[model samples]
Target: MDAIALLELCNYQIVFPQAQTCCGQPPYNSGEASPAKDVAWHTIQVFSDKKLPVIVPSASCAAMIKHHYPTLFDTGSTEHKQAIELSSRTYELIEFLEPILPYNKQSDSSHTHISLHRSCSALREMEVAEPWLSILRKLDGVEVSLPTLEQECCGFGGTFAIKSPEISAAMTADKCEHLLSPNPQSILSGDCGCLLNISGHIKHSGDKRPCTHIARFIAQRFGIQHD
Candidate 1:
């Protein structure tokens, strides 16, 4: 939902789906598979109204809502049938945005230097970063740079980091290692969980805080256009 707010402003219609929910991550991850299945069934009921594509920012959640729910449902039930419909239209936010908002980076943007971070689950291995880069490249003098170990997890896997503080801290340290580069004028990421955790690590570990999020970054760059 972090990015959804801005997506609306970016010309994407927001579909406030019914029964759409937690993707059952908490219960499913907590060994409550039965409850997770219940959640999935409910999700199917909620979203059956419209066929608009479901755009989720988190890869983990998107994949679950798309791929996991059907298996959890009673296969012969009508609900299971509906689950199939939902999955086909589901997309990670970047996946949906990139193809829809194609723009020439060289002509539309102005910035020259930017460093991008890759989300852990979105490990389409930086493929997702393209949309963000495309957007930033349109800025009035922005340059896209590379983050160190951009593939590393920022250690905020929902509640995983909170539950395992030591391991989470170690992983955050790993994410910080690559992102601590001194030269990039700014840094950006698609995930807020990553931002909060990474920023915390940067502060605690003594790394310069890189700017974050393409929307806010663009909002600043397009101040006149917005006004």
Candidate 2:
């Protein structure tokens, strides 16, 4: 909902390709190349338009399409060619919005302090670090802070969390401790996986700080309420 509101604010004619499925990142990250390629082919076929920019909300998914899709096929193959073409047109939501944040309206006068969590994929793979943080700073009353281990992995490396639940849980606990030290009103991240990992830990430990996606945070600043 916030994604829709934010894109609408940007004056983009948003279209959902109902046929679109996964970008095949999960299997690819899990080291299953054959099944990953099959899923990639289906995704490529679904998003067949050569001219449209694929704006992905998740940094991991965007990175998969932009960086790994072409590697799944042989060089100079038709699939590889199409993957390269799609890669060139793909952009993460924050990446797509950085140059065109049009919401200039003032939010409530009350100040908002938020702790930001940038996933390893966003920081390392997608190369998306300050876009969303900078966007929040541009708003009327948002104050953003980074954890001491901001660059550390939240352990939700897609399948990594599933395969190594104990290690993943420890990382999440460590991440949550730092994220809550400042006692911010909310925690924001562009990647849902990180948000989920951190928020779930916080909840189990009886903490209640709101964890939200950056798009939703930005949308609220522009008076766009969730439905």
- Candidate lDDT (C-alpha), each: 0.68, 0.85
After best superposition, candidate 1 residue 123: deviation in angstroms? 1.2
Q: Which lDDT tens digits does candidate 2 get at residues 27-138?
A: 8988999999998898888888987888999998999999999999999999999989889999999878877987555455469899999888889999988787777777
Per-residue lDDT, model 1, residue 13, is: 65
lDDT of the structure predicted as candidate 2:
0.85
lDDT of 1 at 46: 77
Model 2 TM-score, all chains together: 0.96
Per-model RMSD to reference: 3.8, 1.4
| The best candidate in terms of lDDT | 2
Please identify model 1 stretches exceeding 4 Å from their true place.
1-11, 18-20, 102-112, 124-140, 205-211, 224-227
